[model samples]
Target: MAHSPLDPASSLPTGPAPRVSVIVCYLNGANFIEEAIGSVLAQDCSDWELVLVNDGSSDESPAIAARHAANDPRIRTLSHPDGRNHGVAAARKLGVDAARGRHIVFLDHDDVLRPWALSRMTGILEREADVAMVFARTLYWAWDMTIGKEEMESSFAPFPPGRLAGQVMLRDLIRWDTRHPPPCSIALRRDVLLATRGDGALWHGMYEETALLMKILARHDVWLLDEVVSSYRMHPDSMCIKAEAAGTLSNETVSRDRVRYIGWAARHVAMDWRSRLLALTVWLKGEAKLRLAPRR
Candidate 1:
């Protein structure tokens, strides 16, 4: 279905452009879209616009998003013009293209951003001119629980409020770190995102954030915010779970993704032979573990 011809934000008097553009992507996510939009609407920071990309879902997601846009000027619903299921990367790229904010943050339809998430993350980017991305901690919310049952706390990154890390360290961490920020818990500069948005085909249409993060790290410093600013719901219906169910989460797929990441890193950033070798070894070990681990 086509979006409304009339602009949703036109009714409200125009003001200065928003400081943050929140891009949420979803396909057949009617079950959790409302809660996700509610989290964004409930943000303590008011200077933001919600760009909801429906991704041509064959469910109620587009309708729900349209209804939300009708009520709130800050929310805009969009979809692929062809009305087909392009992957998350393409959907996100479309949202980014339509965004009009200085900073950008991505929210998964099944996830949530805490009240202070926008204010806290954007403030860091503003204060630190050198920092290209600001990522925070996330709470792992079990499907049955109202609140997060466990904190996906970081033990490897530099501590407390925040810490800045350079390209070399960030690259190493991605290849080897035990705990790192997921896309849901991070905000990035719009220019950088646009410049590095490679085709969405990496990893055979998986791990889009991994490619984006590597691109960001190649040229910019990353800030690790120790505060928890989002909740990542762990449910069987998640994309990862579905992939696992389809037997696509095997070592072969993981290795292919790792190879793609290494090649991308080599092109963008010059890492020494040792670092590259270390990264490959780490991937091998992880794949080995996955092979040995019992199925759920």
Candidate 2:
């Protein structure tokens, strides 16, 4: 289906521009898509738009997304020309291109945003002129009642809650010295996101967010929040879990992806001598980790 941008004159409710555009790209996510959409609907901040990109779902998720869009004008659904599965990164790019908000928030189909997520993050962005983005802690949720409490907990980054230089954060992320911000927990300026696009058309496989974040950090500073703003559901069907089950989560695969990420960084992110040195260090560390890790 042909996807069109949200027309302010017709598609949106009469008001100021949406403060945030929440993008949820799903592929056969019928089971959890509703809860995800509901979380966005439940957001205390009403000044937001929801774009549900149907990434070639074979199940009833398209219908679910359509139903939600029918009930709420703030929600719109989009897909590729032939409704093909173009991977998460491409679907996200499509959503970003069509988003009509000042800021962007990426919510996975299986994840839920807390009610205060948009308000809290957007508030920081508005007040901090130098900050290009803001991210907070995320709850790793074991929503299945059968699961134990140990599996359900909060994840906090090592960074303090305040504005931080992008280069420093980027280096830490590459070196695996800190917990990177999950996509669900981040809200970034739309303009900054567009500007941060690297040489790649779409980051293939995993580490897509890493590529995007590295680009952003190379150019701007970001704000860190101490509060938990989203819940990331831990389930068997998650990408990492599935990869592990399929034997594709091997160190070899991860090392290859990491190498690709480092190469992308070299071209698009680490321009200065110091940054390049950090990239080299990260590469050496990755090689050592790969060599030390046991084969699947």
Candidate 3:
């Protein structure tokens, strides 16, 4: 049989593989798969892989991925065991398991990367020598797929390597105002993920990014790339919107998730005495407030 245009053998050139692997944890992501895949494929840096983890999507996500993967060896697709929605944490680890690159970037099913994302992020990592994780700013994308403005994310704000990172992190722990773009805009040496054990329990009821951020903070020097490297699409079907719409467990989950992150900062992040004391007070007050709130 002659080769079809859909085959990876026909469309992708097999040569030097990428040093970075982007993990995409997807659920019912059929509509956005192409844009998500295309963003990484268009990266300025050529040495990267796109690991697409299909966590038992109900729609045509798998079929969509199949068509795309057929023509690109760089796109690796893995299915959830027994076709279950194994959550983002598990899906991400599975993506990591399949990754061959030394560096990793993660994207949501609906997010897209700017072409320079990897090239610029890793530029810092390679030069900084001691840094283990890095993240950049994100360009917002509205539901209609139009470009939005650039936004800066929060990290353990400007500090040279040492205990100061933990201090600033602890001070802002309860505020929940510090912005790190979700996993899509973050990149790390593969070692950070390996060290964290990739557990979903880390996130508790909220999503995975916060847990991973706190966990990563424990061991790595995270840097801000300051470039808008990806687009986070805002849509009606977004989990937070639906939760707010239903007015039920979603509220409780978000609350619990917030505490989990604050708790992580309190417990693991090393800080100055004043910062620690403040964190302790904040933790107690927040815990009390949440414990008293009636669950729906």
Shift of residue 66 alpha carbon in model 1, Å: 0.8
Q: Rank the candidates by lDDT, best first.
A: 2, 1, 3
TM-score of each: 0.81, 0.86, 0.79
RMSD of each candidate? 4.5, 3.7, 5.3
Winning model by lDDT:
2
Off by over 4 Å in 2: 1-15, 144-158, 198-202, 246-256, 288-295
lDDT of each: 0.73, 0.79, 0.67
What number of clashing residue pairs does each candidate have, in the order they appear? 0, 0, 5
Q: Which residue pairs come into collision in candidate 2?
A: none
lDDT tens readout by residue for model 1, 181-230 = 66778899887777666523343265557656765675677887878898
lDDT of 1: 0.73
Residue 114 of model 2, lDDT score: 90
